[model samples]
Target chain A: MSVIAFAKNWNGKFKNSTFELVSYTKALANQLNTNMVVLSIGEVAEEELKLLGNYGADKVLTVSNPQLNTLTSRAYADIVAKAANSVEAEVIVLSDNNSGKAIAPRVSVKLKAGHVAAVQELPLSLDPFVVKKSVFSGKAFGHIQIKSDKKILTIAKNCFGLVANPCDVAIEEFALDIDTNLFKVKIIQEEEQKDKVILSDADIVVSAGRGMRSPENWTPVEELAEVLGAATACSRPVSDEGWRGHEEHVGQTGKVIAPNLYIAAGISGAIQHVAGISRSKCIVAINTDPEAPIFSVADYGIVGDVMDVLPRLTKALRNSKS
Target chain B: MKILVCISNVPDTTTKVKFKEGDSLFDDSGVQWIINPWDELALTRAMELKEDAGNSVNEICVIHVGGASADATLRKALAIGADKAVRIDACPADAYHVAGQIAEYLKENPFDIILSGIESSDYNGSSVGAMIAEFMDYPGISSVTSVNLDDDDIQINRAIPGGKQVLKTEAPFVAVVQKGIATEPRIPSMRGIMMARKKPLEVKPAVELEVLTESIKFELPQEKGACKMIDSESAEQLVELLKNEAKVL
Candidate 1:
C-alpha cells in the first residue's frame, strides 16, 4: 500500500501548503512503512516539482494538464482516487487548505473511505490510521480512525514541523484519464486574503478583542504581531466591529487555528472563540480583566492593559536577543 | 434564481456543553438552539441574491436535517426572510446520513445554486456540503466571499490563504460559504419576524439514518486548575514565577 500526497503547480510557484503537506505525508508514510508518492496536478513546472524531494517526498506523480490548474474538486478526486487505486494506496494525505478542504470529503465518498479534515497530529496507530483532530472548533480533541482501506485526511497546516530531509526523489509524470463528468463545478476564480500569513498556518498569532475597546487601538496589536513576526488576528467582536478584517478573525465561528504560539491581547476567551484557537501550543493572554474567560486557557496570563503590556513584551523579547 | 439553502440547528455559541445521562446524548435541558453559525452564510446570501436580481430570486428555500426544536432555527431563517422552508425531519447523526437526505431532496428539485455553511458548529465534521455536491454530481466551490452571477457562469470570489480568487463556474453549482459572504447575517428585523410567521413552514418525516458512530458515554471536561495569581507589584517576581512555576520562559 502506498501513501499519496497532493502537491500543486500553483500560479507558477510551489504553494507553501503543498510543500508542508508533503513533509507531513513523508512522516506518516515513514511511520506506516510504505513508499510515498506526491501528486502534483496541472501544468506544474519541473523546477517547482523538484522541491518535493527536499520536503521528503520519494516519487512525485506529476499530473500536469490544462484540464487541471483550476480548483476542480471532482476532477482532482477522480484522479487521486484512480491513482490511489492503481498504486493500492491505503492512505491519501492532503493539506487542510482551501483545495484540500474542498476535495478530501468528495474523494472519500468516491473511495468510500473514512475521511477526517483539519487533522492536527500524526497517526498514533498505523494499522487503523487513527489520528487526532480538533472538534467543536478547537474546544476539544477527537481521535478518529479511517476504517476503510482508502483513508482521506486533511492535515492542519503547520501541525508538524518542516524537516529538511535531503533526498533526490524521482519525479515521474503519471496521468489519470478521469472523465470530465466527475466535476460538477468548474472554478472561474479563486480569492485570497491580502498580504498576510494565513492565520491557520501561522507559527505565532497575536490577537486582540474588544477590550482594546476601539478600532483605533488595533495599531498596538498589529505592532506586537509585527515585532514577533506573527500573524495578527482578532476576536469575533473585533471583526464584527471592523477593527480587523473578517479573515483576521480567529475563533469558533471564525477560523479554527492551531498556531504554535497564540498571543491574545484585550480579548476574553469566550468558549465559542476559545473553541477555535484553544489548540495553540502556547497561549499568552494579556487583559486587564482578571475575570475574563481568556485567562482560563492562557499558559501565561498577564493582568494589565494590552496596550501597556504589548509594548513591554515586544521590547523585552527584542532586548533579550540583543 | 431559485435558491435552496441548508442550515443546521445547533446549540447557541456560548452553551456550556454537557453530556446527558450516559454521555451518548447531549443534555437538552435548558439548551437554547440557534441557526448553525456556518449555515448563516447560505441563508443570508440566498436572501441577498434574491434582492439583487430585482426580486428574481423567487424563493429562498431553507432546509435542515433535524427535529422539532429545529423549528426555532427554521423560523430564524424565515425571520431573516426566506420565502419558504422544509425540514427533512431526521436527526442525521452521521455525515453520510445527512448527505443522503439532502441529496435525495436535491434530486427532486434542481436548484440554480445551492449554498450551505462550510461546516456545522456542533459536529465540526465539514463533510455534509461536499458530500451533497458529490452525491448529486454538482459542481461547487467553498468559502466563497463574493458571488456575481453573469450570463451563463457564476463569478465567485472564493477565499484562500493569502487573498481571494475571482473564479467563475457555470450554473447549477454548489457553494459552501464562510462568514465573509454576506453583510454579517442581519439580526432578524421586526417586520421580517412578523412575515416569517405567515411564511410556509413544511415539516416532512425524517429520512432513515444509518448511525456509524457509537457514543459510548458523555463526560464533562476536566475542570480548570485553580487560578494562580502572583503579586502584581514587580516584573522580576512575575518573571521568576513564570520560569520556575509555569515552566515557560
Candidate 2:
C-alpha cells in the first residue's frame, strides 16, 4: 500500500501543480510510513517521469494510451482507480484543478473511498484521517475526516509549495482496458498559450476588475503585468462581461490563485473574489472607494481610479528600471 | 429536449460563518439563505436555452437534495422560469450521497441535459456533477461557460488553465457551469413568482447511501492585519515599497 499522487496532464504535458501534489503526498506517506507513487496517463517522456523523483516520489507509473490523449472523465477515472487498486493505495492525492475536479470524485466512487477537495494543509492526524480544507468559499476552514478505509484527496493548487526530497525513482508501465466509445465528449477545438505565464504558476499577478470599464482599457493592466513579468487576471464580473477570458478569471467562481504578490486594481473585493486571492503573500488594492471591502484585507491600499493607478505604476516601474 | 438544473441553497456570501455543537454543525440563526450564485447561473442558462430552443425544448426541471429549508430556493428557481421542481426529502450528507440521490432520480426520469454549478458555494466540492455523470454513464463537462444545443448534440465551451476548449457531445449529458455561462441571472417577475407558487414541487424520498466523509470541525480564517493606506499621489513610493520594503519585486 502506498500514497498515490495523480499527476494532471494538460495540453500534452504534466501540469506544474503535480509538484505540489507530490510534495504533500510525500508528507502524508511519511506520516503513514509508506511510499509515495506518482501516476500519470498518456505518453510521457522518460525524463518527465524521472522528474517525479525530485519531489520524493518512489515510483512512477504511466498508462501510455493514444486513446487518452484527450480527457474523458469516466475513462480517466477508471484508469486512476485501477492504478490505485494495483498498488493497494491507502490514499490518492490529486490537485483540485480542472482535470482533477472532474476525475477525483469518479475515482473515489470507483474505489468506494472517502474523498475531500480543496485541502489546504497536510493531515493534522491520520488515526482518524483528518484533513483541513477550505469551506464556504474560503470564508472558513473545515477539518474533515474520512470514515472509509481508503482515502482520496484533492489539494487546492499553489497553497502547498513544492518541497524536494530527491529519490531514485523506479519507473514502470501500467495498462488498463480502454473503451473507445467512452470518448464521446470530443474536444473539437483547443488553444494552448505556450508562452504566456500561467496564472496558477505565476509568482506575481496583476488582476483587474469592473473598474477597467471596458475591454479596450486593459492595455495598462497588461502593460503592468509585462513590466513586472507577472500574469494577468480579472475578477468574476470582468470575465463575465467578456472584458477578459474566463481562463483569466480569479475568484470563487473562477480560479483560485495564491501568488507571492497580488495587485488588485478597481476591484471592490467581493467576498467571492477575495476567496480566490486571499492567499497572496502580499496584496495591494487600488480603488476609488475608500470603503471597498478589498482594502480590509489588503496589505496596502491606494485610493485612486484603477485607470490612474495602473499607468502611473507602470511608468514608475519602467522609469525605476531605466 | 428535457433539461434539468440542479440548485444548491447556500448562506449569503456576507454571512459570518459560525459553527455549533462542538464545531460539528453549522450555526444558521438569523442567516440569509440564497441560491448558490453559480447555481443560479446554471439555472438561468438552462432557462435561456429552453426559451431559445422553443417548442423543441420540452421542459426545464429544477432539482435539489434537501428538506424544507431548500423549498424557497427551489421556488426561486421555478420563478426564474424552470417549468417544475423536485425536492429530494433529505439533507444532503456529502457530494457522493447527493450525486447518488440525483442519479437515482434520473434513472427513472432521465433528462436530456443536466446542468449544475461547477461547485457548490458552501462546501465548494466540485464533485457532484461528475459523480452523477459517472453513475449514469453519461458524458460530463466541467467549468463550462457556454452551451448551445444543435439537434441531439450540445456544443460546450469549458475553461482550461490558459484557455478554453470547445467540446461536442450528444444528448443525455451533464454540464457543470460557471460564471461566463450568463452575464446576469434572471430575476423573477411578479407574474413569474405568482406562477411559481402553483408550479409542481414534488417532494421525493432520498435514496439511501452511506456518507463517506464527516466534518469534524469548522473555524474562520485568521483575520488580516490593518491595511497601510498609501496616498494616491505617491504611486512611485508604493512601487519603491514593493521593491525595497515588501521585496515582492
Q: Which model scores highest in DockQ?
A: 2
Clashing residue pairs in candidate 2 are none
Q: Write the per-residue lDDT of candidate 1 for residues A230-302, one digit (tens) a residue.
A: 8888889888887688888887888988777787888888888887776676677777888998778877677
- After TM-score superposition, the amount by which residue A286's alpha carbon in candidate 2 deviates from its true location, in angstroms, is 1.7
Each prediction's TM-score versus the true structure: 0.88, 0.95
Ignoring the other chain, what TM-score does chain B have in each prediction? 0.87, 0.94
Off by over 4 Å in 1: A8-20, A23-33, A43-51, A54-56, A122-131, A143-147, A162-168, A178-195, B20-24, B53-55, B150-153, B189-198, B205-249
Give the 10-residue window scoring lowest on summed lDDT in candidate 2 chain B. Answer: B47-56
| Chain A agreement with the truth for model 2, given as TM-score | 0.93
lDDT of 2 by residue, A267-321 (tens): 9999889988988889999999999999999999999988888899999899999
How would you encode candidate 1's per-residue C-alpha lDDT over B1-249 as one tens digit per residue?
778888888778888777655555667689888888878866877777777764456778988888787888899899998888898888676676787788888888778888888888876778778878888878878777777665455678777777777776666878888878876777899999999999999987766644433223333434456545533333345445544675444
Docking class of 1: acceptable
Best by lDDT: 2
